[model samples]
Target chain A: MRTLTVELGERSYPIYIGQGLLQNIASFFEKHQITKKSPLFIITDTHVAPHYLNDVETNLHKAGYTVISAVVESGEQSKSLAVYEQMMTKAIEAGLDRSSTVIALGGGVVGDLAGFVAATYMRGVRFVQIPTTILAHDSSVGGKVAVNHPLAKNMIGVFHQPVMVLYDTSTLQTLPIREVRAGLAEMVKHGLIWDEAFARWCDQHAEDLLALDPETLAYGLEKGCSIKAQIVSRDERENDLRAILNLGHTLGHAIEATAGYGEFLHGEAISIGMAGAALLAVQLGADPSLYTETKRILERFGLPTVMPKHLDTDQVMNAMMHDKKFKEGNMVYIVPKAIGQVYIDTNMKVSAVRNMVERLKEGDIHV
Target chain B: MRTLTVELGERSYPIYIGQGLLQNIASFFEKHQITKKSPLFIITDTHVAPHYLNDVETNLHKAGYTVISAVVESGEQSKSLAVYEQMMTKAIEAGLDRSSTVIALGGGVVGDLAGFVAATYMRGVRFVQIPTTILAHDSSVGGKVAVNHPLAKNMIGVFHQPVMVLYDTSTLQTLPIREVRAGLAEMVKHGLIWDEAFARWCDQHAEDLLALDPETLAYGLEKGCSIKAQIVSRDERENDLRAILNLGHTLGHAIEATAGYGEFLHGEAISIGMAGAALLAVQLGADPSLYTETKRILERFGLPTVMPKHLDTDQVMNAMMHDKKFKEGNMVYIVPKAIGQVYIDTNMKVSAVRNMVERLKEGDIHV
Candidate 1:
């Protein structure tokens, strides 16, 4: 297994990535001097529990740990206050304590919701991320866990890092094609912000990745995690460099909100959002040629490149206004200056963004 | 105004403690370089709203801030998932953004719930504490915000620090006598863990404090905040030294849980819990004389020296088992090593705790 450390001083932890990492989770517990009997609370979504919960439970039990699991519903809706309540109740009923460790098993939704639970439950507790989806490659590493409010996505959450992340790529074999595409969007995002070579590599091996070729998938995951690790280490709280990671996320989050959560997968929204961002970059005189190339590569991966027909431009603008990147009523868009560089622009006018939204609605962009 | 820094590195913020701190809140905003038109969400509980809501609103309006207020019901029950949902909705409707600031304007419950709202809103946002109750002197300054679940007190929350704390002591003038006594329990605890002089001062002037004398009250508030601030600076996440702040809270939280929240104020239960810890300390051979003196002093302040008669020992024990401090199936007790020092004992047997409960029932210790 290869280990990547997310350094945040004392709050730092390692992300272990490789095949069959789940088999040796007990070793991780042992290394941390945490035992199987250390009051383990496993949080998984309904989608994941049916597939991997028993294996995890069996392994934990064999390692001499008492295990209790809380399974939330599967989907974006699961990341709500209602589910957070259910999970906390289940955890309390199962007797989780300060020394107890929570293992979040599933995709981004499960990881984010469960991580928030661990961050708040009993003030805080040790948490482990056993990500079962490709999207979690980003969510699991960053320690930014949160649930969504009905009014906003991820409106309620915390930046509580996991003690360890057991990213067993073997688990991804079970993911649906759509999920794989979602994960690829983030991998592309990593390259767009920091590494041109990795982005080119993804473009070359997109087919290999789609086919679930182990080597190609592993390479992508590792490179994406490494780039994220470096950025998080310098700006753990997203004060500067970290905001670049939100390349497609600003408009992407707005799309997700306007289209209604679960209508478009997070990565799908981001794929289209990236297109919008790239187009906006060109509008601001940042080389429209590079934007076209980026859009072509994203579409080749089967990622969406257009806005959903039903979403209102005005509503989308309102949603963007609520984005965390907005400063003093001004929307701060993280637009790319080039393929391997981006900048946060607080001076961007809403009129420009609205115009772009109108163009998106008119099918000015290609998928 | 007296300014004290929480010293939590990047998360560090200033606590402005004095009469009329609320009137000049715009200056604090200016110091942080926050704008007057910044979207600010003011969170308060029913009990505190009628007293200070209009004034706080007027101040924010006069300072040109686009302010909105969300008022939850008073009491521990208000710290539930339902209330959090309502608050978030209100915040979203009022256009609270990532750069927007949430001002928690009430006692501990409001501070915890509002702080948590800010922590999770849009992944996180800036929050300021405008604590009106004396009990909040401890809760507001330390960034230890949480909302209690039905099964556990503060079982759901986060350690989200505020950007600023506006502690207007004048608001405490109208506080009920019971609340004054309750808030003193924490002041006494601060002294027990760090400063013996402060403890002795509380003991000697317990009556003056109970009467809400401005000088004594202000001294206790400042001392408590300073001690907590020092500990928080060294251990913001409560990994080590900060655990000392929870000296009486291990059992204190259990009492609040078993006694059915809101039946006894947090401090009142903590007062009883401190007596339990003192008894345990004596039994463990950690200077029995100190236990007698501590109990006498607590009684002089009109704090409870025993658990309420209606509470069952077994029920309390069961609740204690669910405490977050429990490690490896063993509960870690913070027993006093002396009047001004304490040690965490993980080896303490459950049987010993049970025996102490029996002793209390038989009137073996003064109530």
Candidate 2:
């Protein structure tokens, strides 16, 4: 078992990663002092519920913990105001109180939605993040839980950290092939933005990660979570340095919103956006190798490197304008300077970004 | 203007209490470094918009600020998921970004709804509280912003503090007589929970307060805001000392929810809950004067001292069970030991509290 703490003083919590942790979930709850008095609420999606819900429920019940679970649909569309309210209804009906804990037991969609519910339920409650998909290796660690607005992704949320994060690698064994490919987008992002060596390691270990090789996958999850935990610890509220994590998110979220969510997974949209960032970096006088290096990595993972031609550049720009990162008339674009490093260019012009996004939409090629 | 700071270190903000401050809102905006480049979104309800919205907008515009306004229907019903979604729609439509400011320009309902929108819009933005009702003296000071669920009040929200609280007493003159009375309930509660002399002052000056006597009301607002600021500074998240601030809110919220939200104003419902708490205190072997004295003062302000006879005890009990306060089959009741002091009782029985609530409904002998 490997453990990483997010170090948010008084609000800090541990992330436990290993095999079969879900089967021993009761012991983790006890170790963390999550109260057994108030009924526990487990929020999972349809895909995850079918596989692990019974194991978790039976184990918790045997250990004298009262468990209540609600399962939603299995995609980004479920991260909406309607679903959020539905989750709140289930929580209130289940008699969950301040002491009750909400456990997120699926991929990124489930983790974000459940974490958001835990953040605002009764003005905040205890939350446990149990990521079942590789993509959640990033989302699950940051404590940036939110529901998407119709116009934008993650438009409504709070910086609500979890009491603990329990990641069982056993769950990753069940991920679909495409989900596995899409999930590696963020693991690759951690390297692109901060660690050059890890970027190289990902390039070398791409086949193993895709095959769900236990040792390789676990090491990647640890490295990804550790980088995220370190960044979130320094700037929990994203006032300064944390914005670097949004390297590909600006255009990535725009692509998702314009494509009408669920057409492409979150990591897939982000993969395209990261590709756009690299191109924009080259246009902004950064080395062309930066763009080549980023695209190479994303493609090696079988992720999308180009935004589809059908999605209009103007519509995507409009979506970017509505994002939290866009302030005043300027887009807070994150530009990659090297494969392992990025910088926040707070004054990126709309025209410059538009020209780069247009290049991606038009499939301007460089190998 | 009289000022009191909420003393939360970097999150600290000032509460400005006086007349005509709204007319000079641009100066306050500049004083607090509310940017002029990003547009400002002011959320007001129908009741407040007619009298003050144009004045605030015109002044801000004249001072070179881009102002956008959204007027919601008045009262507690506006604090719902539907209304919250609508407000977010307006925010996005108006092109509000992370650097933009959200000004809540009404009473508690507007403060809560707008503050909530500000708290989560693009994962939060700068917020200013421009309170226009007496009830806001309490709600505006604390950063507890939320929209209510069908089953519970403030069941969905966060602790997002504002850049400043700008309270212009001039707006209070337009408040309906009932709102004046309802607003005094919290002011009286601040006294009941922390300061004895303030309680006596409220009792002695009830007539003056009801008449909106400037000197009396101003003194009371300053005192109420000061006590609230101190308590919030000590415990921002309601982990321990902050729960004391919910002295009457446990039953207060249940009464509000069971009555279907708009039927009773927040302060009025809390008024009846305060009366019930006094009755419960006496039942728990505290002095009978605590009940008599508390009831007498609430009545003097024309606040409801008894729950309606028609509202079923079982339904109210069920609603209380859904509250953030009730937990582990126990009611976390706040009992008054005297007119001035209170202690949190963590282990009170649900059945025992059901009896007290039944007493409130049956209108048992008192006074």
lDDT of 2 by residue, A1-367 (tens): 9988889999898989999899899999999897878899999999999999999999999999999999999999999999999999999888988889999999889988998999898788889998999999999887899999998889898877888899999999999989999899999999989899999999999999999999999999999999888898999988889999998999999989998998888889999999999999898888888888788889999999888999998999999988889877677999998988999998998899999988886565662
Instruction: Tell me each candidate's TM-score.
Output: 0.94, 0.97
Where does candidate 1 stray beyond 4 Å?
A286-288, A363-367, B1-3, B10-12, B285-291, B362-367
In model 2 chain A, the worst 10-residue window by lDDT is A358-367
For each of the candidates, the C-alpha root-mean-square deviation to the true structure, in angstroms, is 2.5, 1.6
Of the candidates shown, which would achieve the greatest lDDT relative to the real structure? 2
lDDT per residue (tens digit) for residues A1-367 in model 1: 6788888899898888899987877777788777665679988988889888999888888888898998888899888788888989998998887778888999999998889888888788888999998889998887898887666677777788888888999999999999999999999999988998998999999999999899889889989999999999999877778888999998899999888888999999999888888888888777768678888889878998887778988899888877667767677888888887888887789999888777766555532
DockQ for each of the predicted structures, in order?
Answer: 0.70, 0.79
Candidate 2, residues B228-322, lDDT tens digits: the string is 99999999888888788887888988888888888998889999999899889888898888988898899999898888887888999888888
